[model samples]
Target: METLANLEAFMRSAEHGSFSEAARRLSLTPAAVSRNVAMLERNLGVRLFSRSTRRLTLTEAGETFRHSIGDKLEGLQAAIASVSADGGEPAGTLKVSLPPTFGLNYLMPLLPGFMERYPRIRPEWHFENRPVDLIIEGYDAAIGGGFDLSPGIVARTLAPAHLIAVASPAYMRHRVPPVDPTGLGDLDGIVMRYLRTGRIRHRTMRDAAGREVFAPLRESLVVNEPAAMLEAALLGLGVALLVVADVLSALDDGRLVRLVPRWYCDAGAISLYYPSRTLLPAKTRVFIDWVGDAFKARKLAERFAGSLS
Candidate 1:
């Protein structure tokens, strides 16, 4: 039992690269986490981590040990959860990661209902743009699009990530609207650059008739975040490519209008992502099912579908 505690501490410390971070996840003091790891090292007669003033790093032995035991921990946790099912009631912290604006605008509305239903399930969530490691970061789930499918992670698609060209009515007053996707090249484009890679991305827009053409717009203004790019478009800076879900309200209120409505870029799927656990925690399982139901009830798939006209 003491060995199990040490193993848990060691694994979390290795994942986060700090006893403090591991302690936070485990709800233990940093000193306790450090002591457990030291005890584990003494028992094994091998130093697991090389500590520095700035950070803690795993040693070669630690890496080997982690590789041998890391996956087994999940199995162990699943077994424990199965034995202590608490009469199938979902309880405990449900930690999740969500995209900033999308989570706020879309998901936040459904939370009151979820809370009312699952009174024992505490939601610990954060809004972040960057990709998160579900296992390493201790997140039960994440919701977003454009994540690389990593090992031990699975995604359930919720909606199509459809992007279309949009601009304020004021901006297009004197300017001629694009007759085709190719005509967008001549327009002043407010573009978003990839935040992590700092690379400008261009995509081919497809029309209802399946004709695809690449928009070769000159990037007059480049921004990283989508909100900023939308701001530029709203301020009549230029024609901007934006997610249909993000600007749906503006388009409806006549603040912004869709350009070349037949053409849209299929940016992939917005999905709910979780670790590929054989035996998922009841809290996580319920949340996944509940959210899926919510999306279906809201007709989010149809609403966020790629433009056909």
Candidate 2:
């Protein structure tokens, strides 16, 4: 019988197009993956991959083998996971990815309760600004906005990523409050530069009447991080386009206030992305349910819809 490890190594290497990348996903050294592939080749009596310094291209035989075994491997993995989770008690390392500021502000508070409930599951999470390749990076789940709908992944909408114009009370006191989006040109703006694209993000604002306007920023300060932009606005630097969820407390406590009440930007949906809905492990399933319940309890999506009274 062929070793499961060797078959998995061959499958991952072919999927990732590189032994190093497969190693990363499998949490093994490249040498180990290479050795496993070599052993598999010897056992099969056929060359599976065309080895190159920069890439690993599959041979015809390898492609044929992959097509035959790919689905079977997934089934095997699902079976193993199901068997391991015998009592539906989530008992493994739950790896996840999240956006930095949003995770810190929103999800961090829920961690203690989740840990207390799932004492057998160890949480391993990273806060990143960019979208992570969940399968390639071996994350169980990810929470963020603007992720590509990649193949073999599913997303659940958590909230709308609504943005609005805000400024410190001290900054707005000396200036005329903009009645509409176009009037924003008169004030100094604190704006965000896209970290991935390195381009300045322009604002597209819409009013309650569905009237849309393009408000190009006159940036007095350009920041890449959303947290920094919030801090700058708090220091009375200038008017800023910020996520309502991030500054809800500030707005409620009279530290910051909305500039144009009728106009706000609809960025996208904040979602929870996972590998497969059918083969979801108990840990991820419970976490998803818990997060959804938390959002409902807090009325997060409705309250942070950019219309704060």
Highest lDDT model number: 1
- List candidate 2 stretches off by more than 4 Å: 17-20, 29-35, 47-60, 86-88
lDDT tens per residue, model 1, 32-56: 9999999999988999999997779
As a whole number from 0 to 100, the lDDT of residue 38 in candidate 1 is: 97
Model 1, residue 87: distance off in Å is 2.5
Give the per-residue lDDT digits (tens) of candidate 2, residues 176-287: 9988889988888999899788899897998777789987668899999998999999999998898888888898899998988888899898899988845677788788
The C-alpha TM-scores of every prediction are: 0.90, 0.87
Q: Candidate 1, 255: how far from true, in Å?
A: 1.2
TM-score for candidate 1:
0.90
RMSD of each predicted structure = 2.4, 2.7
What are the Cα lDDT values of the candidates?
A: 0.88, 0.87
Could you tell me which residue pairs clash in candidate 2?
A: none
Residue-level lDDT for 119 in candidate 2: 96
In model 1, the runs with Cα more than 4 Å from the true position are 38-67, 86-88
